[model samples]
Target chain A: MQGTTRTPSQPTTAYQPTDRTVPTRSPDRASYDKELVHSILDEGYVCHLGFVRDGAPVVLPTLYARVGDRLYVHGSTGSRPLRMTGAADPGLPVCLTVTHVDALVLARSAFHHSINYRSVVVHGSAYDVTDPQEKRTALDALVDHVVPGRSGDSRPADKKELAATAVIRLDLDEVSAKLRTGGVNDEPEDLALPHWAGLLPLRKGYEAPIADPGLAPGTGLPGYLSAL
Target chain B: MQGTTRTPSQPTTAYQPTDRTVPTRSPDRASYDKELVHSILDEGYVCHLGFVRDGAPVVLPTLYARVGDRLYVHGSTGSRPLRMTGAADPGLPVCLTVTHVDALVLARSAFHHSINYRSVVVHGSAYDVTDPQEKRTALDALVDHVVPGRSGDSRPADKKELAATAVIRLDLDEVSAKLRTGGVNDEPEDLALPHWAGLLPLRKGYEAPIADPGLAPGTGLPGYLSAL
Candidate 1:
C-alpha cells in the first residue's frame, strides 16, 4: 500500500475540457466515459505521446501498455522526456493519444471529405515511477500489455538494467474518445456531380507470424501470438 | 503553371540536409531522399499534427495529402490551428508527422519489446494557403493522395465552399523519416531462456470491398478499388 499513496506535495493541474465550436459536435467529444476510454487504450499497442519541451512541442511515437486504468510507458533513462520527468521539479504533463483510422469518407463535394476514425486523448500530470517495486510492476504491466501471457515466462529485469531505465505512469482519469464512422455526407447541390464518391475502408490485420531467424528450434510460436 | 509560378510572400524554408537526424540504425532503415519520403507520405492517409497551443502541447489526428515535398492538411476554417495560422501575424509553427506500424518485435528480454514502424516528421512554419488557385491545387493533391485518380474524377470545389475551408502547407525541409524493420533482437544471454521470441508481422490489406448500400445498382466496385 505504500506504493499506492500519492505524494501530497506533488502539484496537480485542473483540466478543463476543450470548447466545442461546432454546435452539432460538442466539446464533450473532448471527454469520454471510462469504459469507452479504456477500450481504446487497450486495443492499441502504440500511442503518439505529445509533450511541450522548451516552448516547442515534440511528439514521439512510442509503445504503451495499459493496466486497468493506468498507462505505463518506458524508455532508456537517457531519453529526453524520461530524463526530464525523473528529475526533481516539475514533472512532464503529457497528452497521450491512441487512434485508429477506420475508413475514408469520400463525400460528393470535395470540401466535405472526411475520414472515419476512433481516437482517445488522456490528460494527466506524469511523474516517473520512483519506487523500485512499483517500477518493476509497471514494467511487467507494459510487457504483458503487448504480449499478454509473456511477462511471467520471461526473465525479469536485473539490477543494472533497472537502474538505466525509466518508467512513467498516467492515470486514465481525464480522457476523451471520439469516433466518426459513416459514409459520405455530401451537400444537397453537389449530389448531381459526376464524381465517384464512396468509402475506401481501411483495416489492419495480422498475417502469418514470421519467426525470428535467431529463435531456438524447439520454441514454436505461442497461441496468444497466433490469436493476435 | 499559374499556381506554381506565383510564390506567396512567405519564404520557403531551405532544406538543410544536416539539420535532420541520422537514425541509429541501418542506412536502409532511414530515409530523407525525395522518392522515399514521398512514398511514405503518399501511402499514409492521416497524420499526427502537433503544436503548442497556449502552453501545453496538443496532438490532433487529421487527414493529410502530399505533393512533391509539401504536405496539405485541410480543416474547417474555424479549426483552432488552422485559424491560428490564417491570422495576420506569423503563422503557426507546427510539427507534422505520419507513421505506419509494420510489425511487432517480441524480444526475449522485456526491455527489447518494440514495433517495426515507418514514420515521417516535418518541422516547419505552417501557413494558410490563401491563393485560390493554390488552395484548389492543394485540395486536389489531398484527394488523389488518398484515392488515386479520384481528384480528376470528382468535382472541383466551388467558390463559397472554398472560402469555408483552409489548407496549411508544411514543406518537407527539416524533415526526418525513421524506420525499424526486421526480426526481434534479443540479448545474447537471454537466448537460453525458455520463451518464444519472434516477430508477429503486422500488415494492412484491403478486405472484400463493401459496396455502399446507397450506390446505384449499376455502379460496382471500381477497378482501382478492387486492385488495392
Candidate 2:
C-alpha cells in the first residue's frame, strides 16, 4: 500500500460524554492515528455517504477525493442533503465510510468464519464548500484521484457547470480504521468437525480499455490509464 | 446484461410527493420502475445504511440481505441508531441505497466523463423487527444472502445471541433505480485531442475456497459451497 503524509499531526477533538457512539471490540479494533486513517481513505475512490435528511436517514453511494485533512464530495446541487445543508440548524451529520474486503475467512464452525478487510469510518458534520479556489482545487483532486494526469489534460469545469454542481467538505476529525486479514480462527474442538474452511480471496482490478467508437484513428492509451 | 424486465413498474407503495426527492436528473437518467429497482437490489449485497444519532447524520458500510419485499440489517443492540427506533417520535427515517459500477465512461473532455452504474435508492420509515418469527426469518435470509446455503450448514443463532443483537426491517417501497452503461459519448470537437478515451470494465467474483488448515479428515467441501 502507498503511504504518504502531507500535514503535521494535530490533536483530535475531545470526546463528549453525550456522544452515543458505541464501538465493538474497542481494544482490538479501534484506530485513530492520522497516518492509518489517510492511507485507507487514499486507496478508496468510492464511498458510501450516509446522512439524515428531513428527519430521515439517507445513504448515497458517491465518488470522493481527499486533499490534505479535508475530504471533498461532489454531487448535483439539487440533491436532498446538499439542499438541506444550505438551510439547516445543525448542518448534515454524516458518517462517511470506505471499505475494501481483502479476503474471505472460512472457519471450521460457521460462527467463527468472517472476512478480512480494511475500512475507515468518519463521523462529523459536512458543510458545503463555497470558496471558488478551494472548490476548484478539490475538483482537480477528484479528477486526478482516479487518473493522475487527467486534471490538466481535459477542459476544466466551466463557470456554468461549477454553478450547477455542489461540493461539500468534511474534516477528518473523528475517525477510526478497522482491518482483518488472514485465515480463519476455528475453535480446537470444532477443528475436528468434517467441514472444510479457509479463505476465498477477493481481488479488484482494471481490464483492457475498450476505445469508444468516436475516438480518432491515431489516438493511443494515455500512460496514466495504461499504468492503472 | 440481464435485462430481466424492461418496462417500468412501481413497487407496493404509492409515489408520494415526498418520495420524488431527486428530480434533477436528466429525463433519460432517472428510472421509477419496480423491475429496475428490484433487479438492482437483488444483484447487490452491500448497502449504504444512513441514519441519525444525537442529531448528526452517520453513514455506515455494512452487510445487508434482502428477503422478498423487505431488507434486513442487524448490529449490536447497543448501537445508537438501532436503539433509536425504540424511542419516542415518528420512528426512525432511513434511506437505504445499493450501487454497482459497471464501467468507466472516459470522455474526450474530462468534464463530460462519467461512470456507468446501476443504483437503487429506497426512502421510508424504519422500525425494529419485534416479531420473533419474522426476526428469525430475516436473520436466516441474511445468512443465506451471504452464502446461499450457509444458514442450513451452520448452527442457527441461539436465544442468547438473538437477545444481544438488534435487527431492523424496512419494506421495499417508494424506490427508484438509475442506470448508465455503454461507451463514452465524446463531443465532436474534443475527438481530435491526443488523449485516449475508452471504457475500463470492472467486475467482482469469488476465487477458489481454501479449506481451514485445522479441519480433520473427511472434511471435504460442502455441496452448496462447491456449487457456488
Candidate 3:
C-alpha cells in the first residue's frame, strides 16, 4: 500500500529490463526498480561475475561498487576477467549478480522451503576504464564499497600501483532485482500439520579487529572500522 | 610443508584441471586437491550457478550441496535455470562457484588491496537427476547443508512435493580452488608508508529466530535453532 505508492516528484531510477534481464520464471518476483537494484548492490560487498570464455561459462567472485547508475569492478590488470576486456575491443560481455540471504524459510512441507533473499542481476558489457581521473574515482568507490569512508581514511594509490590495477565499468542497463521476503509459504493443507515452520535470519557482521602483526602499537584502530 | 606433501596409498580424488579451470591470473593461488576443494565447498551454503541462455551469460544464486564427488542444486521445476536443463539434450553446461570471503586485506597501496577469500570453480555440464531416491537424498542434503541435522528435524517431501522440485547435479571433475589468506601483501617499498594496513575479518552468523506469526501457540521452538 503506502510503500508501493511512488510520488511523481520522487526521482525513481527504475532500470529498463531487456529480454535478457527479464525473469523467465516467477515473473512476479522480478523488479526493474532502480532504487531497489542500487540498494541491493550497495549493501553487497562482492559479486559473482559470469562471462563466456571460449564458449564456456566462467564465474568468479570479485569486489564491486555502485556509483549512481554505473557499477565498477577492478582486478589485477593480469587477471583473466580484467584482461578479457581489451582496450580496442568492444568490451567483455558479462553478467554480474549480487545476492543477500536475509533468512532461511523453513516450511512445513519441503516443497515450499525457500530463502528470503534480495538479488540483483546485471546484463551488459564491461568496458575498460582508461581515463586517469575516472580510474582513480572508480578505485576509490571500490574501497568505500567494502567499508564506507575507508578511502578517505586510507592513503590513495600511487601512479605505479594505478598502472598495475585495471578497472572495468558496466552501465546499469538491462538489470533486474528479484527477491523473496516474509515467512514460510506453506501449503494450505500443511498449515494444520505438526511440522514446525518459521524463518532463521542470517546476519553478516565484523568481528573485533585484529591489528596487523607489524602494526605499530601507537597506531590505533581507525574510527570507521571501530564503529563496525 | 607436510600439509602440501601427499602420501601414497591415500585415495587421490583431486579434480583434474582442464584449460579453463586453471587460474590464468594468480596461478599460485589455485589448488587441485580433493580434500581442500571439498572443505571449501562444505563451508559454503550458497553458490553462483552460471549458464549460457540464448547465447548470453546468466548467473543466479542458488542453494547447493556437495555429496561425495557430486554437487546437487535444486529449484522449482518452473525456474528458468532448471527448465533450461530440460531442453532437448543431455543437460545444461554450467559453471558453479562457491566463495567464502574470509577477510578484507587492506594494503598500504591500493593496487595490492584485496580480499582474503576461498573459492571453488566447477566447470562442466549438469545432468538432470530424475531418480526419485537420488532426488530425495539430494533434497535432504540441501536442507542439511544449511543447518546440520535439519533434514531429520523437518518433515520429508511427499510425492506431490517431489514432483514439483527439480534437481540437477554436476560432478566435481573439473574443479579448482583458489584462495588468499593472512594479512595484507603490500608493496615492499610501501611497507614503510604511514598508512594502516591489516586484515578485517567478515563473519556470518544466525540471528534470533522469529516464529511464524500464525504458528500454533503450543508449538515450541526447536532445540537445535535455539542453540544456534
For TM-score, the strongest prediction is: 3
Binned by DockQ into CAPRI classes (incorrect, acceptable, medium, high), candidate 2 is medium
- How would you encode candidate 3's per-residue C-alpha lDDT over A1-228 as one tens digit per residue? 112222322235666667877766776677887877889999888899999877879899999998888999998888888888864398888999999888888877666677878999999999999999999999999998987887876668878779989999999988888888777777667777666689899878886777767754566778788888
- Tens-place lDDT per residue, model 1, A103-202, is 8877666676777777887766678999999899898888887778878767778888898788998887666676776667777676665555687777
Q: Which scores better on lDDT, 1 or 3?
A: 3
In model 2, which regions exceed 4 Å deviation?
Answer: A1-27, A86-91, A108-110, A186-188, B1-7, B10-22, B86-90
TM per candidate comes to: 0.87, 0.86, 0.92
Model 1, position A217, has a per-residue lDDT of 63
| Model 3: pairs clashing at backbone N, Cα or C within 3 Å | A14-A34
Error of 2 at B169 (Å): 1.2
Computed on alpha carbons, the lDDT of every model, listed in order, comes to 0.72, 0.71, 0.82
* Per-residue C-alpha lDDT of model 1 across residues B60-120, encoded as one tens digit per residue: 7888888777788988887788887888367677877788888777888877777888887
Q: For residues B127-177, could you state the per-residue lDDT of candidate 2 as single tens digits?
A: 888899998887777766767777776655667768876888888766767
Q: Looking at model 2 chain A, report the run of 10 residues with the lowest lDDT sum.
A: A1-10
Give the worst 10-residue stretch by lDDT in candidate 3 chain A.
A1-10
Which numbered prediction scores highest in lDDT against the true structure?
A: 3
Candidates 1 and 2, the one with greater TM-score: 1
